[model samples]
Target chain A: MSAVDTRVPQPTTPTPPSPRRMGPDARRVTARTVRYTLLFLFLVFVLIPVYVLLVTSFKPGTEATLTGAWDLPQNWTLDAWREAWDALSPSLWRSFAIAIPASIVSAILGSMNGFVFSRWRFPGSDIVFTLFLFGMFIPYQAVMIPLRQLTSDLGLASGVPTLIVVHIAYGIPICSLIFRGYYSTTIPNELVEAGRVDGAGLIRTYALIVLPLSAPGFVVTLIWQFTSVWNDFLFAIFLSNTRNGPVTIALNALAGGQLTDYAASMAGALIASFPTLIVYIVLGRWFIGGLMAGSLKT
Target chain B: MRSRIRNWGPGLLMVAPSIVVIAVFVYVLIGATVNESLTDRHTAAPAENYVGLENYANLLDDDRFIHSLKNLAVLTVVFVTGTLVLGVLWAFLLEKGVKGEGFFRSAYLFPMAVSFVASGVVWRWLLNSAEGEGAGGLNALFGMAGLDVLQNPWWSHPDWGMAAMAVPAIWQLSGYVMALFLAGFRGIPNELREAARVDGASEAQLYRHVLFPQLSPVALTALIIIGHMSMKMFDLIMAVSGAQYLTEVPAVYMWQALLTNDYAKAAAIAIVLLVVVAVLVVPYLIHNARTERQR
Candidate 1:
């Protein structure tokens, strides 16, 4: 059906009304009701799983089973949450230990690479950058066996440092792309020329001029890198043993039992997800912008 | 000449670590994997000698690899269609403008922030296949509504279990697709819509003929992103269903093969996955590069 019926006169703005309908009042009522109903339904759909996780985790194991899945717990208890936290917190701490350093290192490295590619382009820099971009799409599956062999040979098998190095290596492409894109727009060649004219060397120009002007770019890259590394399960599971595993692996193990401890599992999921969720809730716009930037370069 | 050499040195130094890291980890590793795939690794330790596409041919006879491919095909179709339909629909609804738009937008995107591992845990609980008093989550909701007949074996059903896996996949990624489409919708200027309306086009006709054509690039981008994600899907399936060969995708198959030290088979699976991902992503990369060059 046509959203705007040809028979009905359309409003100039998006506030939906049809002058040719029965009455303006009736049309407005219909539009509002329809909009609210649709939004409410979609909101419920989006929130239902999250709601279940939250309520179930807040519930005692018995209460979670006895109550309707959607019902608020009659006797709210943090027992499941405490148990899950006690079990999963070490891995959570390990994830933080891995992700933060990895993200920071990647961002700084990406910034330098971005600076060279964007402002200080040399011969074949474009080719080199394209080579880096290809790394973004190479399925980790393709590289894992060899990577595993390489790491173990080097005595880095199951090392957090190895995970950080792997993440930084993979993180280079998108982070560089983002920073290059940002610098190409935000920092002009004239500024670099200005620095050069002052007899500043390449490193000096970058250190004084480019580095200072890159906070926003750094934020975007850091958030993107942090989230990807933190949430990564494939690499963590393949590379690290249980003792050194990240929260993702721990949470997977928590949920991966025969007798499904639904409440504890849900609690573990919630606890494990907090860091990324906090980043999203606080800097959501930037996070969405980062996603768009990484994918929609064209 | 010395000054010029020195001038180039700093920039190269800045990018040297990245170049070196990528060369070893990505390029050299890819070469090593291709080499491993061509060798015979059925023994305790992998053989370094070439076998001339034997592993590739062996994949043709491997029932599980073929079945996993079929399962992947099913997952791709279901996951891609669900993400696109739901994503575009939500984008359109939000574009129509609603009260508390920010709240709804954030709510829609919050799922994307939660890792697939977490989502898989929650979904497994909700979609639990237990019948009667042991029923929980959606099945429980159905039973409470006196729709006991409606409860089905979600991921436990032998036939439709693969399709049931799409539920969690859609939940995690559709919001990302929505964000993409929403950006595309917002990028379109109001003048175009006004111009279409002035030309006596209905909104449906305007969207079908004009807006959709503009959004096709975005649609392609979404397809590629989702295609690669689902094809290489590992964690969600591992968490939700735990390597049930019925829902085994290539990534999982590769993981199992690696664990068993079947290096050749694992390398073959990895190569196949790489090629599939390349087929999905290379065109987009080339297109992006071309456009960047044009700019």
Candidate 2:
């Protein structure tokens, strides 16, 4: 009798089949229709510009400017893509050269830092961590002058190596924050205690226990660092010369040149964005999770 | 003492590299910048003597610097509010259960994956405000629809130029804000709504009483993050408009000052930007650390 009573009270059940329900039913339907309509309109507004960019990239140069922005190309061509590749391939390589070393070094350093801060308790540790946290919010412009002097003084005035060093040095704060947040939440101190009880040293415990549990955090930090370092323009422009510039600066120059080729510029934009776009599409859920983890909760 | 040394030594050693690197790159650099800003160094050399508050005072008299500040204020107001409104609306729509939730969600965030430089490239072309038959971008869309009156110069117009830049910004980040809000909505337990429904609460009443109040933290997070991004905005304006006076921001001015070897002024501008960002971010960090402790 109790089960029957509990199961019978679903909200989806008909409300006594009343005739008075007709007015509310119509109103509910109207409201739902309005909601759907508004959502669809907003979707259209969000996507139209992206659609324009994609279609414009496909159009030949003349058609892109001559026809209406909304008009589809009569015939697609790969000439623009080919030209963009030829023009941007060197800087694309440079971006990778700068981004890869930077990501790996920072990830390793950050993982170590995170372990110490999260698992190891010491006097003044919280203050030290807070000091590091401050770096996450310091605008890069503030450090530009000193950074230039430091790089030049070290005989790395303008090149991939300088760019690499700059990125790794600056990437520490955010990377440390991400890793610390991840470890403190998911890897409890009990596990570390277990490893230590087995007579394992600090490095051994980290390598044996924590690292195995840290693959996801590593992926998150890697993706974040790779995208950030790859997309960076200010540091690229400030730290390196035009000859060894990253893809972003080169693309900017290409698009902002005296005679702007609409088709080629659009094509270059698409090409330059394709790498990060692929990462986003493939790992977007985890990427979003990482972003939320870094901001929320703390 | 020996055991304590063994214990503390390893942990400190593991963290030492990051500490040294960040100390050099962040703290030491900040110290150097503050020193540079207070001096009369015009070239790449070290400061000769201190000139207290001279650079900041000069900035007060500088029209271009004042214009940049004004533009920053406009961008911050418009970008922050626009992103919040649109993002919250989108989140509400998604929360109600849309058909293509995954597709729309990904599509919305796709812009964020791309660099601002690339967005600037496409938007620069899209917002080209050529007159007559040469019209392009949104202006071209207007021309096609025969709404000639709607055609306005974007990023080129004297007034509202920075407002135009805010469009690309909102487009890139509104989806991020939406994701933030959607997470908030999902975090609310269904039992709360069920109880409200059992109490015969209307949908509007349920939202007003339950959902809105719970979403306040998410709103604060969004505000702080967006405020920080807007204040430090550089690459987008640089890519879209170059160094045009109409669209010059403090970051751009700082870059230009460096090019002309005006180290003091550049350092001053950088310090100003840093102070603005610190004011917004410090309170949030303190709150975050405190809450983490309670947790």
Candidate 3:
């Protein structure tokens, strides 16, 4: 469980050098060099596309050709950025509109469910929790046909609101799973017992005692939900369109269309990725923690 | 019993919303899809008749569906294996304590933040199949390095296009694998390694004999996660290949069917996908539940 807290690897105290069994100084240096060299090469392999994206995004139209994709921009300009923003800004806002509220609602719902399932367990709670967890693993396509039908039947299709509701519905499993894991591990039974001894019921214990301690859980779930919702393409494409789709749909349109504005497409990709990228960078530790927590139960 | 009900009532009520959502959206909707698959609801019309196993039967002879399944098999195997291998290697490297591990880890992971659609756009460019002077993206880089032999049609290859698509998939997910393996590495007790060291285990032997066995659980988890993701892969293919038959998988095929108002066929495909995933995931979920209970 402590392994789950994979933040930055802490530097450990160095073991005293033993030249007898382990090789001498030169051999160790060479090994270290080889390791660093391999890491650098992998680093390069990983960043190649990123390099292309950044350089291509900054290039003017004439210089942004695929043949010169690896080149730095000769005429570095913001035109592509402006063009991408013009095309994608509305959808960007729509993504925020979907992700912000969806994340908040799901996080709240998850917190309550987590509290009940973890602390206030009823008989068969484990089975129910397992059932809920199964929902997280389902292929959305299996439910897509009916989900679309249901949404349309309710007059909720092709809109941000529909996407939000859909996201929340689908989000329940992972969000609650994270919060449930968080509450069970971090929030001790004694606190719940203490609250119960003080006449705090489930709702009251959650609001007064549990909720305050839930900031970490909320952070993880919110970031996780917000990223998934923001990055969602399948739901965005199915439930909405060019008129009101999220950034993913718009980015797909911008890049997938016949007239390939290479610079604008690259910029659009970067733009679509900006919010989640920011979330990942800023709340990276918790983001990774949430990721592990959602997947690995223990 | 009255006191038990009293104690259970609020807890039940608290979790009711989640249960309802999962019931309606997941379980009930799956049931509805199964029902839809069994009926003859081809068009957008409300007319539906019981067709029993006709759609599934049709798929048995459907070449496109079979080809899509093959593509899925190639993609899943390549994607899952590539991600696992790279993930373990990088995790092992990081665990060995490199300089600026934080920067390397984040750089490796930043792609996880980028959407598949967005990354697909760039990869489509990177995987451009042109040759000679027209070579661009990775091809151009290969040409520059005088590795012209390595430069070939990537995702556009007729035989192994799906494998090429797995390249981007691996790029996006291997970082996640690395993080998981790193965690697995961290979780192991130090004394075990020290004991193995004292027994004259070489560094390679230490990892091969001592470390790799303990990381099997993490590897299985990674395999399942990557496997399920590969099964559900739609957006990446759609973004990269644009419904090209060369890279088409079941999810994309289902979407194409839905677009043509072939509800029954789409539902059948979706049900097949659901069954496949359930077969893969349910046992793991059950095992996870039993383990957690024992703990």
Candidate 4:
């Protein structure tokens, strides 16, 4: 979830003549320290909730009552973690069963659309692409009514299918945008023309040339889509009955309006948070880097 | 005729898959929703009678809907601004090469990957009332230490809870924004910074005058991304208020409508959300489209 800070490669790509250097202002030292102090305070402010979440997850219900929030746990136990897992495992899987396929399907179709838009220019191509672009503008509420009815009609009601469709349809617009943008940059015109000259038709060229080049972008888009769909709670709750709902629905379920299951709630939360943490530790830089470089190619 | 067929050939093969999928699942479904808003039909089947925007009229007057919409407006403002400011500042700090860069980056980014449901649950414990989740961790420690302000009803108080709701969202989002800004910051020429130093500009002045302008495009990019995110912000809110059957964001509101046999009203809310998104999304998407065409 770290926002990848990427700007245009203006300084590095285009060689510039050497220029004279400037030195840091010695007179501004005290002022700089004050500014730095303010920045650190803000950083601490931002970090407070995280500290709260981590500490609360560790504290026994009684310790939670007795100790202050900022202190390290006096009696930390794995019990909350155990409880959260037992309570939320089913919901997490239900979410994944829906989100994973929905993202894959969206990525597959979106990739194909991107390839076409990037390679062959057709009569209605721009208009259709425009419609897909327009799709990104649409809010979930606008489509919820018809979608709920449609879900029931298809006999996909109250389970993974309903959630899957919600995610897939929503997934298409952004995925296609990223894919198409990536293709337009990485897949050169010369390569495609050369493929055409070799008598390789459209599908053949995609299978051989374009798809391979676009793999990085596709993987990047997949990760992004997976996170979004997995995190979403609206459709899973609305379209599906509780049996097939995601972790979000279950977590919310812990709170019966006024009352909440504190220990069970924190445990369920910790388990649900695992996927994104794993992604950051493993695929962190590439995901954000690929997204910015690919998107900013525009 | 032969030429005409050939011209259409690649289009059919290449574009048809995308078109069919989108049309069946998205475009047509959206069209169906627009139709539903004109009727008050409920229960298992859509009656498809013209109720002449009666649903829209009733929605305009509905207390809960109005309240949610007002709350939604407040939410959008806070969410978009909160994420952007903190996100950009974080991106700056990460980019500027402070100590423990990697550790801090990971610490900040961890919240994002975990499910909001999970994060929401954790935050509830953090914010819940003394009678609710108790002063527990921070409150107990801070309270005993005489930091009494920390013991306030942080989450139970409605306005404060809303801000508290934003805390996790901002936490999850800021790291990503920081990464984006860091990327953009690295893109700037070293000479620019050096030249500012030679000109005797303060670091603050240098950032204000030099780095900030160059980062505008990157900032713009972050703005649009955060806007879409804030628009779809249901999970955090749902977790905060308990769930759809209770707290009602536009998305949750729509969901509840379907659950309670108010399909038309649900569709109306959904459509209204889509329209609001369009106001933000269309321009940015178009800008992206144009930028891509240039590239």
RMSD of each: 3.9, 4.2, 3.7, 6.5
Better of 1 and 4 by TM-score: 1
Residue by residue across B1-295, what tens digits does model 3's lDDT show? Answer: 9977877788999899788888999999999999999999899996458989999999989999999999999999999999999999899888966668889999988889989999998999999989878999899999999999999899888879889999999999999999999888888998888888889998889899999999998998998999999999999998887887888899999999999999999999998988888899999999988888898
> What lDDT tens digits, residue by residue, belong to model 2 across residues B1-295?
8887776678888888888988999999999998899999988777788999899999999999999999898888989999999899888877756567788888777777889998898777667768568887788777877999988887788878788889889998999899998898888888888888899988899889988899999999999989999999999998888887999889899999999999999999999999989999989888977887787
Of candidates 3 and 2, the better by DockQ: 3
Question: Between the candidate structures 1 and 3, which one is better when assessed by TM-score?
Answer: 3
What TM-score would chain B receive for each of the candidates shown?
0.92, 0.94, 0.97, 0.87
Q: Which residue runs does candidate 4 get wrong by more than 4 Å?
A: A1-76, A155-157, A255-259, A290-298, B1-8, B42-48, B129-164, B189-205, B243-248
lDDT of 3 by residue, A209-281 (tens): 8988999999999999999999999988888998988999999999998888999999999999988999999
* RMSD of candidate 3 to true structure, Å: 3.7
| Tens-digit lDDT string for candidate 1 (B137-183) | 78888898899998888878766777888888887788888889988
TM-score of chain A of each: 0.88, 0.87, 0.90, 0.83
Better of 1 and 4 by DockQ: 1
lDDT of 1 at A165: 77
- Give the DockQ ranking, best first: 3, 1, 2, 4
Off by over 4 Å in 2: A1-24, A197-199, A296-298, B1-9, B44-47, B131-133, B146-149
The positional error of residue A77 in candidate 2, measured at the CA in angstroms, is 1.8
- Report the C-alpha lDDT of model 2 over A156-182, residue by residue, as the tens digit: 858798999999998887788888888
Angstrom error at residue A272, model 2: 0.3
| Candidate number with the higher DockQ (1 or 2) | 1
lDDT of 4: 0.69
TM-score of 1: 0.92
Compare the candidates by TM-score and give the number of the best one: 3
